[model samples]
Target chain A: MTGLLAYFVFFATIATIYAIIVMGLNIQWGFTGLFNAGVVGFYAIGAYACAILTGPARDTLIGGFGMPFLVGLAGAALAAALAGLVVALITLRLSEEYLAIATFGIGLTVQLVALNAAGLTGGANGLYGLPRPFWSLFDSVQAFNLFYLVFVVVIGLLVWALLARLVRSPWGRLLRAIREDDVAARSLGKNPVSVRVQSFVIGSAIMGTAGALYTGYVGFISPIDFIPILTFQIWAMLIVGGSGSLLGGVIGSFVIWLIWTGSGTLLSRLAPPDLQAQSSAVQVVLIGLIIVLTILIRPRGLIGEKSAVSSKK
Target chain B: MIQAIADGLSTGAIIALGAMGVTLVMGILRFTNFAHAEYLTWGAYMALAVLSVTGLDAGQTGPFRFGLGLVLATVIAVVLTVALALAIDYLVFRRLRGRVNHITLVFASFGVALIVRYSIHLIFGGAAHYYSNDLQIAWLIGDGLRVMPDQALVFALALLVSVVLFLFLKYSALGLAMRGVAENPALAAINGVHFRKILFWTWAIGGGLAAVSGVFYGMTVQIRPDMGFQLLLPIFAAAILGGIGNVVGALFGGFIVALIEAIALLWIPAGYKIAVPFVVLLLVLWLCPRGLFKGSSGGSK
Candidate 1:
């Protein structure tokens, strides 16, 4: 049916957006061994930035530049990269635990700001009517959705190619070297801090791009969309797929998203109407279980790391 | 200003109790237990569950809102929370110990936190619960300042527990073994210290303290599934500010963080109170990475 086709297109488009986010996480966490617990922060920045740039002019709200789609995307990435740079510079020198806590706090702080800063972020209601890329060209909703899906796929491929090239380059090797052992890399005259900063910024920018793409596709943006759970979901995707592998990150995104959406649908149909609200809690529990089981059983994940980055003590 | 200080002390007491477990786990386990906050939630909920079953949540004991029934429920909750912590360790963490990297453990803890928090959410509906609906008059302590008797009780009990814990760690053999392992795991193992025993006791004490804090928090504030999570940042800030491994420092840091948050309300909106701990945490991490305390044998390395 046309309905099924449309749903599939929508699902694939969202999944691809998540894949982009996962790939970004892979760069910071998988490649650089940086525990960025604040994926949502950069993500929120991107979404808000894009919404402000491309959205129609509003008297109450801040920016309504009505920029081109690509310009909005670029602005999102820049904003996210700036945030990533600040976070990395401050917390990268600390222990992994400290970095994790700091990032988590930062993520929460971003959410708080979004909730409070009414004029800028349109408060909790959030900015709506975001201009979708090439939306006006299509007559039907389905046609537009299909067109957007193709556009997203193309962007996804472009990102993949860019990341693939970067990882294969000398700079990518340096990231891996630093990840494996920062001291050894430092001894080899490689400045691990600067390299980590670069990776963090790039990864954050990619997350921003993903956020911008999500805003463009969904046609709305809100603070509620960038909760800590979003970060956790991306983490689950990366961990399940395989951290160090780009293919694994992409696969993990689809797999996890499928399971997440499938569980929701299944739960809605199966559970009684009264208990429907609690079903989300069940889904979260499942996510938590998957994370635990995967870490315990398959630390390397399903696809496993292509490189010989030692996970063992 | 006086009211703010009073509220800060009460909040600090709760944070200190919660941070105690975190700092200990970080010291001995060498990983931040993100799930530790869930213990507080579980503790509060467990107490509520017990009270609801017994229909003992209504009675008020003199000036305080909670009665002997709540106290009994708290004891039961402490035991249950300890069991929960140990069970989690046995099932998940114990298996992953030294097998994976510290970051992996941290991620696992995140998962664990989500599981525990949502499990509480699934069991208890999203609605907030209270131990007693009884109204108590706030005691006028100073000029234009009001302090609740429950706050005083919570502060006293938290201080009492902290002192007892400090003394226990200083004098007790098992506590000494735990400290030894925290300081130098290899050396302690070589010296015939039972690492497993220390780990067991660490969880026991941590869980027990967390339960008390949770109960105290529930007694003062409304009990919600997400209360533990809301408190997580402040607790971490306290622990880090005090120095990660130092128990006394965590206690001190908790009060300092709480006081700052409370006083900052004079300038900033109350909604921004959540950001206060994060700012303190950032400042501490930026300025004093080792924390305000000079020496703590455990996590400083």
Candidate 2:
């Protein structure tokens, strides 16, 4: 029972993390119509920033501020926002599709830099021995996981409330107007560029916050942990949950990760010895299939849009 | 120095062939088809099947040498890749055709990429495969230079194919139609050009070229599921650097990308070779998205 309780808490922590990242994506792609495919880049930056700030001075290449986890989290969020601001300046003027491609390329470049810049990052090996949120107090895995999940959930709910507020505001209305028809949106005295940059930077900062939380929970960070596929996975969770819906994003993350974890465990029994080496790989393929099938059958997702016209469309 | 240039030329040739496939589709379809790399993987498997089924891969140095083996392999892979491209067009892409939004098309391509990559994984067992070749045939040619015959053949083939594609795009009625479709589909249709027909041929021929690049790549490197995927960013970087819909730009971009990947090792770690193309991609996107030469000619004429 305790093992099950610990596992649920771990899973909840992950779901909270995805929800945070997806909220950022939802702002860009779902609300503002800017397809920021480089969500992982910002996420990774946030994690690294937080890790470096609070992490011990020995393993780190720089930023041995040796600050508290809270301070590190704030710094990570700021850095992510700054990075997003830079990327947005380069990409926001382009078409949505072009932005997607550019964002993807930027994400690749970020991952590459993360992998090669061994001094700042730990290189391909990744950074370890990170200080968890309460290193001085919480000792057990379960206690830490429990503490982190509650902390993350509080943060996640706060983000949800903020996003929920933003989309409903006049600013939210303007974003939707742009998504539906950009030319029309521009005709109404709204500067699409500024709004896009704003949404992108803000959402990216949220993703950064998630990254900080994720790093704190895992107590390690690596380049391998931020693959291109991760961008898709978070996107999938948002899609599966229903875009433009904060609650849906959180729910989707839980469902998708559960299936992923469940399949990883179940596949071991059916997989042969030779295939065993590639079992996790096989799970990845299944996830890919899941995304494809889900999109094909239910474009809006399980819960989908509530409106009849939108849902039908 | 001369030998490295020769190898670079060979690598450029292979990349150009892949670029042609990508650029042609991007030109006509009006979306940077991200799944194009999957075609190269298909081509490798196609050639592998032929090599396995009919012991035809082995040959002596004649008119029908590795060159001929390549041509034959090219034919099989191209045909299969074209069909696969069409299947993707019909099954996944065609449905999303009217959606002019790039990311939507990207989503569709991601689906196609997932299906193709995993299908290849299911079939090829995710392990590396190779054409049985051990003959290095490296020779000294004065002033610290070396040449490998296989690399030479691959480059020669790359050159031959690029010229043929240039001519095809230049002279043929089909070529004109393709340019028409690429420049402005609505206007091209107004002139009675069948966009779908041109797209069909483009997908087929593009798949063929991607296959050629794949075969040369497998010959030079190793055949694995991620082989084509690993090349995705570099190929797109080249295509973008070359210009969105320009063939020559794709070729030059491919070479620049190849050069960077080749020489980046001097400064960066050996493991970070892939980063060279990606870095070039970011720089080009950040600095100059219009190809160094020009762009798709606007096909305005």
Which structure among the candidates has the greatest lDDT? 1
Error of 1 at B258 (Å): 1.0
Report, for every candidate in turn, its global Cα lDDT versus the true structure.
0.89, 0.78
List ranges where model 1 is wrong by over 4 Å. Answer: A307-313
Give each model's clash number. Answer: 0, 0
Q: What is the TM-score of each candidate against the true structure?
A: 0.97, 0.93
Native-to-model Cα distance after best TM-score fit, residue B52 in candidate 1, in Å:
1.7
What docking grade does candidate 1 earn?
A: medium
Per-residue alpha-carbon lDDT of candidate 2 for residues A265-309, written as tens digits (9 for 90 to 100): 888888887887567666667666666666566667766545524
- Evaluate every candidate with DockQ and list the scores: 0.77, 0.40
The first chain of model 1 has a TM-score of 0.97
The prediction achieving the highest TM-score against the true structure is: 1
The whole-model C-alpha lDDT of candidate 2 against the native structure comes to: 0.78
* Count of clashes in candidate 2: 0
